[model samples]
Target: MPTIKEIAEATGRGKSTVMRAVKELGLRESGHANPDGARGALIIDAEGASMLADFLTKNVEAKQAAGEGETESSNQPHIDVEAIVSVYRERIDDLKAQIDNLNAQLAIKDNQIKELTCALDNAQDAAKEAQTETRRAHDQVVLMASAGVWERLTGFKGLLGPGSDMDSQ
Candidate 1:
């Protein structure tokens, strides 16, 4: 983290100027007591420092370009091709990295979906097997009852026998 004073010194500007720029840029800052106990200093991170540097560079370049154009009596503004190319290259690289990250995340989600689909298929197979087993057990119970197995096992001559009231009716 760099303090406001350090940023001002590095940019060769006043503290108030740096402070105003920082505030206008919406840079993040934290307050900490200075070494000399002069209240608190606003500390900015590397990102904020870089932003300030870029701002100062652009401001200086604009002023210089304006002065040059005015002195030369030329209507065309000065264009720095190299600086523009460098900035574009940085942006392209940043976008490519983001694309790679998104692709990786998409692949992970696709794998998860495949695994879930397989699990659902297995669960469906298991449910079909359970239903078949239940049907088979029901058939076995019906056969046993028709063959008088219940009477042999429990020794109870029920009405479902050969000469029962149901047969007469």
Candidate 2:
């Protein structure tokens, strides 16, 4: 298999642009990943080679045929399968590098999301527990007041005066 950069160089186009074209052409990496985790290139048969050649020819001609302001030299030369494929191999390497980078980023984001979710759950649980504690404390204070502890502390006054026990009345 060819690297996309090599393919682009041979085709007289930018590397990224050629890479996109190859991807759009439905070319997938073989399952073999390099140490960097790029899909390795596959060995193409005659039919695949011919197809690539035809694609290059049509691509070059299409651009030239558009009758835009391109110079004569701007049009690509005859397509050489061997050279193009050579460049394509390098492009495949670059693509693998990109894939590795994206995978690493995704892993980091996944970890971060997991941590944040855990923290959120902990915070929610803590809030609920705190609310329960507050409710329990309020109940204890109401019980103490209903039992008349406040009046007993003051040792009694006239029944109808300030701080008197209405319950007794």
Candidate 3:
């Protein structure tokens, strides 16, 4: 049993508001009038008061949870879209830079390949000239041997005219 003034002060509500709420609660048949019927105070049993307090606490908690859930759901799509766009932009920039680098490397490799091909052609020409010079020198060596200015190590010689030993053989 508490006075209206005590309930109002404890709950931070006005006395009239407390009295109204008490009357509303009386609909549950939980409140009672005083024995003498003089300025009757709201009387609630201990179990009934506990039940009412529990119900009020649960109701407030439910409302708060519902509000938080609505806010989170509303913002979820916006957050996901922003994150996806940001990652896509970053990847596109990275790929563009990589392509630019590859183009530069390709140009360098093309120039190097051209240079190597030209050098290889020049080397082949030089080798052909060297082989011609070597064959001319060998012909001179054989002429010197036939003229008796040089001696053949194997003593095998062939004449270079119509009477050549190779022709007869």
Candidate 4:
């Protein structure tokens, strides 16, 4: 005889699943006094467990066969191929429109990048020109100072005279 746990282990299923299978297969269970002080225990002989397993296997095979038959019958209904093709065509057109819109956006971005690059180049050229002008002005100031032009313009002769403290330097 096998307990519910032993049958579950043998069948690789839960106790409740084995019990349901036993019930569905109409297998009779023997009643025995519970060693753990419970009322009774329901057990199945080896022959009954084997019969239950066989019955469950046949039942599953039958269900699978019926499911396959149902699918075959369900697929026999007439399908409109033209409608499906038209739906796919519309989807393709929509995807093409999306591609065109993306291309337009990319073109706009490229134009903006080109404009920004041109503006950067112009700013760099202007900066170089400003540096050159600054250097020329500095050279003109040094030349005038060495020639005592500032002192002559201000009428301070002794301040920048040839033998004075400024000339000795």
Candidate 5:
């Protein structure tokens, strides 16, 4: 991370210009947010610093090409290419870390979905078994109701079919 003043100095632009570019790019704050001229410095994230440097490079280059009061020593715009590249690298690393975190969360959610689906299938199987048992019980009731009182009172012998006489035994 770099400060706005550092970027402005490296890019040969005013601090106000760098601050405006920061606002325009819609950069979120990861550093101190004291804008009322507080003692703390407004540090910029790597992404914002890289973008700010790029923006300043183009704007300042255009102005310099117009020959705006430049001696032989001041002909070229002062830009720290190495620093800008470093900022870009930092931003890329940050993005990679975020992707890894999101992938882990996605994996967890996928596991949860698999567990829920298995539970539902098991519940469906249990309900089918209960239905089969209920049907068998209903069939037994129908058979008992159709038989005469004496036959039904015979219990197992009645279930063995009609015309069962056990009186001799």
Candidate 6:
């Protein structure tokens, strides 16, 4: 509990206003005696103080609605909305540019992938051709081995058969 004077000091209102609020709101005063067996002074509790605060806030808002609550802050300056919007637009443009750059990089990587795939296909075709040539060379070696041992021992030619290279020449 606090006296109306103390409440006025804490709430930044006059003591007369506090008393008027107590009267208007029908707030209760302290009734309990002190431990020294003395009666307490006229005071309102936290609940009554809270009611007074609400009552004051409503009155101020009502006055403001009636065009009478103009304060120093409201008289100062308005916010720069165009400047803020311009800053946001610049940020959006920067983000769009970054997205364009990333898209270009993605396209380059996609081209590289396509080129690598084409190179791999060409390498595989060359490897298959090399394998075919190696197989043909192996068959020639086998045919030469199958020529008669006598022809090899005597250093003779044209003795393998009609299909031999010497006969063809």
- Steric clashes per prediction: 0, 12, 0, 0, 0, 0
lDDT of 6 by residue, 1-169 (tens): 4566655555555778767877777775442211221554555544455566566556655655676565535542232334334434545676698899999999999999999999999999999999999998888678768878876765446545566656554
Error of 1 at 102 (Å): 1.6
Tens digits of per-residue lDDT for model 5 on 1-169? 5777877777766788788887776664543223434766777766677777777777767876876676547545577777677777888999999999999999999999999999999999999999999998889778767878877566646464466454322
Candidate 1: misplaced stretches above 4 Å? 1-19, 29-85, 142-169
| Pairs with steric clashes in candidate 1 | none
Per TM-score, the best of the predicted structures is: 5
Error of 5 at 148 (Å): 4.4
Q: What is the C-alpha lDDT of each candidate?
A: 0.66, 0.59, 0.54, 0.60, 0.74, 0.62
Candidate order by lDDT, decreasing, is 5, 1, 6, 4, 2, 3
TM-score-better candidate, 4 vs 6: 6
**Candidate 4: residue 96 lDDT (0-100):** 90
Q: Residue by residue across 1-169, what tens digits does model 1's lDDT show?
A: 5677766666656788777788778774332212233665676655556676577657757777778746654543344444434444555676688899999999999999999999999999999999999998887568556766665566434534577554454
Best by lDDT, which number?
5
lDDT of 2 by residue, 1-169 (tens): 4445445555666656654555555544532211222564333333343345457667777877895685666344555656756545656676788899999999999999999999999999999999999998887566555656656565433323475464454
Name every residue pair that clashes in candidate 4. none
lDDT of 5 at 112: 100
Residue lDDT tens for model 3, 1-169: 4455543444344667555665566624544322224766554433333333333344446655778846544322112233233334545676688899999999999999999999999999999999999998888677756665333432334434466564464
Worst 10 residues of 6 by lDDT: 28-37
Relative to the unseen true structure, what is the C-alpha lDDT of residue 150 in candidate 2, on a scale of 0 to 100? 58
Q: For candidate 5, what is the TM-score?
A: 0.68
**RMSD over all Cα atoms, model 6:** 21.3
